[model samples]
Target chain A: MTRNAPPPADSGAVRSAGSSGSGSSGAGRPGFLWAVPAAVFFGLFAIVPLIMVAVLSFASWDGLSDPEFTGLDNWRTLLDDPVMIKSLWLSVLLTVLGVAVQTPLSILLGVWAAGHQRNRAVLSAIYFVPLLLSIAAVSVLWRAVLDPNLGVPAHATWLFGDGNLFGTQATAIGVLVFVSTWQFTPLHTLIYQGAARAVPPVLYQAAQIDGAGRVRQFFHITLPQLRNSIITSVILMVVGGLTTFDTVLILTQGGPGSDTTISAYYMYQKAFKSFDYGAASAIALLLVLVSTVISLIVVRLSGYDKMRSTMEGL
Target chain B: MRKSRPNHLAGFGSLVWLLVVGLPLYVMLVATFQSRPDYAANGPLAFPEHFTLDNYVNDLNSGFAQYFLNTVIVTVCVVGIVVLLVPPLAYTIVRSRGRATTTVFRLFLLGLAIPSQAVIVPMFFVISEAGLYDNLIGVILPTAAFAMPVCALILTGVMRDITPDLYEAMTVDGASPRRVFFQLVLPLSRSGVSTIVVFSALQAWNGFLFPLVLTQSVETKVITLGLYDFQTERGVDTPGLLAAVVLSMLPILIVYLFARRALVQGLMGVGGK
Candidate 1:
């Protein structure tokens, strides 16, 4: 993974002096012009809209009208909006729950799949099927599979008990978290599988020689060795969970009320549904802030930022 | 050096997980092949009394074919844009010493943090403002943009592995940047290019929120949006709905079967996206 690769040694200073002409020592190096097209395109769609989100958060606009600067009104409304508060809470709760549920499960499954056994290979292949499905497809499939009257719940009454799973807040949120877990665990398992395979067999061998049990070896050696992958997987889960929109839309529509309306969905509702673009922008900004802070913390902790120069080493 | 103890606990757990994973899939497949009346009568877990292809036939006739085409167009265009732009940009990031190139790389790093959902409000405005609203171009542009950061990161990683000695040899032979790019860089980064192709294609194919918000007409609707509308419009038609769900994944499943390694590597790279 790029995250663990050493920062590329800075050879730019030595090469830049001769980079002025095509036939210079740096003649083989592509110039900054090569990056301009992608940068401009990304800036237009991503960066420019990000700036517009910030500006619009402070302004009032419907999809039809011109945005008018309203000072702090949108921000003030969001601060007071109970649903906004609840949505933030729900986002956090779901994200944390996703990480908690998926981490250990994926870690175990990943390490298990890392084994070279043929059955492990077959089982892992089956395990990976869910990852191939889109969120919409998965949510739609689960919705049918778990339908209260016509689906699994109808037949498995002993387990589902009326099967109005999406009718209540707790069950609705549970469905969201579970569907996300079911859909995403395989990807994380793949990550951990790769990481686990890369763990030195010597470490596990030494631990075995010391009479460490399988569980003990997993705890002391495997767990520690998987630290970086854990961080990478957790970060992906956090971001994916935070911006979880499709599953919510397909499965519950954040519903039975605003019960499952996490921030992302709520923002969607505010802008597109209610046409409150200003308020939606505010929520969008908040989502960005939260994700950015979380990403920065993880990147800093994992020294991912240091890997930014990975290209320089080439 | 290995313990010979059969791990009953893990075996049990794995079987349980297999059931959890496999059961729904079985239900989906069975439902897709059964008529609605047959499905409702048999329940999701039941074996089909009479297998039929009507559900799939009905879904395809009901505009799923168009949705699939739209999705393919979006996927191909997104992949094309990513392929055309990203390699050169990644090449620049890997080989250039210019300060501006470094800035460009960092910009993509920041791009990683900007989820499409976050800027969607303004994205709606921007697309509409550009007169691309409700057009496939509207969906295509932003989807490609969002796919770029991850594609750039992956390709750059692949390019960086080209060993400086290889570039030095090419340079000593009086190869220009273009010559080396074609002869050495492009060929060596084949895996990375394929990975990005798979990555960006998946993004465009599976994209929902962008199409959900941007395009409304059936003509522009992608498969994901088509499925969403299918679920919302006819939620009770389990067989038809599941068939559409199955259809939505069929292309990727085909890709997965033929290029499992590349597809898996591509999905793992999506951790960044």
Candidate 2:
């Protein structure tokens, strides 16, 4: 893709030429030397592992011993397996549920917190607690909090009159989504709050002068202004949720008929449990495809090209 | 006609929202104090009639002190390395935009795409060969390397936001590049540096797949590994487990308690930009 592209802007070329010009004449040799370690580090660690993953994905063998030539076999298995197909669907479902739940909740909280700058610090602290904790801690915390026999849900049922409030498959999925949102919303809230705060107070005042109520002002002034952050946070959450493991591994382990077994969990089981490295690599490749597609969609929907060019050039 | 007072719906809504958000945290804290029977019998939110420091004391005996230390060591080391390494690279990228800089950053961006799950198996072989297989540094090095991309990406965004004129003026005043970085850029980018700290800390602390798959011995286990041990050894001990969790969360919680505003500000600045 880069082959046919125009050269980078003339400014960079001019800068490099000027640096080289100075170095040849022995005027500005000091600055050029400092950039060496960074370039080398990036090449060694970042560049190499990526090429390795691509190479390994096509070969066949367990992670131990030697890998043999097996072109297209892994990819072919991914194309045909029904379980693989189902997990893909489940991964998509998790992403959708997470994004659907988190985006609006975070936007609302962000708007509310931004509206009251006095309490913003305290409110942000409260919301961000989950984000600070690890996924393991979150899983364990929720496991204890949601334990059917000994959890808060049981007590809530005692007060509200209960049988089994969360034993159903839908409820199980709902709980996972809820935990994900709890972990993520504070982050998006902060993003939106920043975006909302950046919006001129004059805009809100102007709307108020025009008799726009808070609700109307939110739709008109807040949501539109926060489009970029909202989209960015949503993309991050969706990508994360689809690939989620630690929480599910701790909470459900994809239990009750494997209802919560997203592609990520399925991939782990297939690779490690079933000893199907070929299948796992295929699944990994497919995940990359799915992520790439989703990211492309986000880029298109958010007009990220325009955003990047506009934001980066200055 | 008498006009009614302003509607209190917004105030009422916010109060309800706050309660909804705060209730789960209350449950976690409360659960840590109650005995197993009390927790099992009364449900998670019950006020413990017999409040106990026993859970905390028992946990201290449960081999978590080492786990906590390991977690701290790994997390501090990862964050320290990432902060020290990523900025110079990111600074260079921001200041000197060219084929080489962009190529390096794009490689880092690939790290963003390459999930740890994909790399876990190969990484095990790599770490074991380095004789760091069960060492804390084993987990530390790979996690830091993998995290470099995102950290560099965020730092580059921040460093880019600094006005180039500052760098130009410093150079004219005979400050070297490293001097300009330490004196002018680093201080100016305090928010960005703190953002990387908060971010890298969460990544290292929360990481489970690496530590779980790579490390075997108790001496190398971090908090996530400790929790896994909690699950296996005392799986039914509700209060003990919760106590351990609360203990695990304490350090980051303390950091967040003070700097959440900075974190939010950082997210807004780095992420949104």
The native-contact fractions of the candidates, in order shown, are 0.75, 0.37
- List per-prediction Cα lDDT, in the order shown: 0.86, 0.71
lDDT of 1: 0.86
- Leading candidate by DockQ: 1
Say which docking band candidate 2 falls in: acceptable
- For residues A50-132, what per-residue lDDT tens digits would candidate 2 score against the true structure? 45556666878786778876888877777687766776787788888888888888888777677654565566667677777
Model 1 segments more than 4 A misplaced: A1-25, A301-314, B270-273
Candidate 2: tens digits of C-alpha lDDT, residues B33-72: 8787887777777778788888888998878888999999
Candidate 2, residue A3: Cα displacement in angstroms equals 42
Give each model a TM-score. Answer: 0.94, 0.88
Model number with the top lDDT? 1
Interface RMSD of each: 4.5, 6.0
